[model samples]
Target: MEPQLLHTVTGQVATVVIRHPAKRNAMTAAMWGSLPPLLETLAADPGVRVLVLTGEGGTFCAGADISTLRGSPLEAQRLAVAAEEALAAFPGPTLAAVRGHCVGGGAQLAAACDLRFAEEGARFGVTPAKLGIVYPSSATRRLVSLVGPATAKYLLFSGELIGTERALRTGLVDEVLPAGELNGRVAEFTGILASRSSLTQAAAKEFANGRTDRDAHWEERARESGDTSEGVAAFLERRTPRFS
Candidate 1:
């Protein structure tokens, strides 16, 4: 089958699946380029309260298809960075549901999400060193943020893969589950996220992503959103909050 990105929505969760199983879901140049626009479309949809990124079959993504780099490695790296940035900037909650190998560009994509949940056997690596390519500065900072300077340097400098236990311990992954339980857990978590107040989630995401100037802006949104009132009313009435 041709390598492609597949999109599907169930309830409020939108999923983007990377499909290139013959190469363990390695991204083609076109696949990398397609991601930003696809994310933009999903972000604009009011029905999309959450996004889940994963790979078809088991492997998340091996990296950019190495053959695509023959023309210009720099260009491929640029495309990957753009896609990663877009994912990081997504307005609502985003999660990466990972299994098998999530390395190189795959790790980049997963890192861009707000949360990552992996299966026990999943392996993660940031492998530019192996290819003798400089990893992007933004991606480097993000890695440091997630795993701290020591772990990020260990992965980037050595290009070695880490198992789920170390990954969760170092904060590279938020949760690690057994083989058959990953999908169910991701669904449960995302459903809870989808049911929360969007106003709160949006503001928290921006603040967590380092937008310090948005405090006043989010305060205004909260005042106008009616979610606060709805939440209090629901609490008093002993019912679920109907957050618009």
Candidate 2:
């Protein structure tokens, strides 16, 4: 059978599983190609309020599948870039529920998400140094945004996997649950996000991301938009905003 990128929706949450467990959920090129469309579909679907990215067989992604690189190195490189862009631009909140080794591209995947809830036994790293490679721009920007430029430089320079405790201290993970308790913690977290208003969540995320990069035009646009008024009214009425 073709390698699977398992996907399923439950209520307002959808999970995209990295399924190649025997290889520690290493993703092949074809699987990478399929992910952009899958993410696009999820982003467009009003029903999906949140997304959880996990792995099969107790492990998160190990990185790009090296075996597939032998066929077309250049194509593989381009595809990987596009995949990261797709992930970075995903509209809804995304949570990475990580365990085992989250290394190399695995680190990139988790970094792209809105939040990361890690297992107590989790490990994470960006291993470009070990592979004699350089990290890409989009990935670097995302990492730098989360942990600051100095920390981002240190982690990339070291290419060393860090334990869950250190990962949390560095702000790489939002929470570090006991190894066996990660799944339950992530379920609880996603359930909370799913129950919230999707429109408010999207706008709040956008505002947060753009907080540092202020634009007068954008501010004016938001001011002119009447959604905030309706949101305030809904709050007073204890009702959800009928966002247009």
Candidate 3:
């Protein structure tokens, strides 16, 4: 199949699958360029509450297609940074459903997500060192925030792949599962996320992403959205909340 970003919405979850099986799902420059616009479309949909990014088959992503960099490596890096920032700024929760090799630009994309879940045999690396390309500063800061300065340095400096156990221990991934159970768990968790209050989730995401000035904004939203009242009523009445 031609390399592309395939997206579909089922209920409140939108899944974006990276397809480039011949190169272990390595992202082409065009694929990187397509992500921001595609994510913009998904973010605009009122029905979409969560997004799951994963690879087409066994590999999540190996990295960028090296051949694409031959013409202009800087331009390729620009596209990649744009795509990573777009994914990071997605309004609702975003999860990276990772398996197999998540390296280089693939690791960059996964790091941009709000959460990550890896299968048992998955491997992860940030490989700019291997390519003699300097990692973008924004991406580096984000990685530091997630896994701390030391661990981030280890990955960035060494360009060595780490196993699932090390990844989880260092806070790079939120969860790990056996080979076949990842899809089931991802579906079940995203369903729960979709069922919760969008207002609350939006507010929390803003705060967690380092936007400290949004307290008043979120307060106004809670007062106007009716979600708080619905939550209280649901608790008192012994039923699930129907958050709007």
Candidate 4:
């Protein structure tokens, strides 16, 4: 069987490719099943500073592999929930490099990431409406967290695939680059992130995640942490922080 998840480290940056391009990179249950452990491996490696998720070929993802999703509805539910939870809780920063079709569970996976960089031709949608399956609540929350409740409702209710500009207007993507520029831009962005102090990066992710839910003292406490002090000092001295 072909491996569903492909992981490799290039210096401080880690790359994960969903390797089913023969099917527009649609994820099978097994693919989703393997992601958490792979992400955990990167998370535990102190050497890894950044993670990027992409699909082989020009497509980002076409969502769930409904071909194998036959009569086992309960099994399908379990897999979907477990798959999304794994991505949602992955430690360290992650970016989804998107190009062609990004629909259904593929969109959920991207929604789990900290950032999404889409190619100009990328199309995004939450497609449970067409599939007759409910969009899991956790996935819904993540989508709403990105683009607000109304926009989330719009995508969920309509099963509509949107253009890159519409996605950007709704904050579904951080950057949209031309197809020729997508790979290089993703490398450039993650390269910058890789050079930042990991301790600061991890702490900042935690702090920002809390801020979205209206966590109090998150900012104040983070600013008081040793990592923050080191970051400020590094900036003042025009040097990189050596966060321990």
Q: Candidate 4 on 144-183: residue-level lDDT in tens?
A: 8899999999899999999999999999999999769998
The local lDDT score (0 to 100) that residue 191 gets in candidate 1 is: 96
Once model 1 is optimally superposed onto the true structure by TM-score, how far is the C-alpha of residue 9 displaced, in angstroms?
0.8
Clashes of each: 0, 0, 0, 0
> What is the alpha-carbon lDDT for the whole of candidate 3?
0.96
Whole-model lDDT values for every prediction: 0.96, 0.83, 0.96, 0.83
Q: Please report the TM-score between candidate 3 and the true structure.
A: 0.99
* CA lDDT, candidate 1, residue 151: 100
Residue 106, candidate 4: Cα error in Å is: 0.4
Alpha carbon lDDT at 134, candidate 1: 96
Worst 10 residues of 1 by lDDT: 214-223
Q: What is the TM-score of each candidate against the true structure?
A: 0.99, 0.86, 0.99, 0.89
Which 10 consecutive residues of model 4 have the lowest summed lDDT? 211-220
Better of 2 and 4 by TM-score: 4
Alpha-carbon RMSD of each model: 0.6, 2.9, 0.6, 2.8
lDDT tens per residue, model 3, 163-205 = 9999999999999999899999999999999999989888888
Q: List the residue pairs that clash in candidate 4.
A: none
Q: Candidate 3: which pairs clash?
A: none
List clashing residue pairs in candidate 2: none
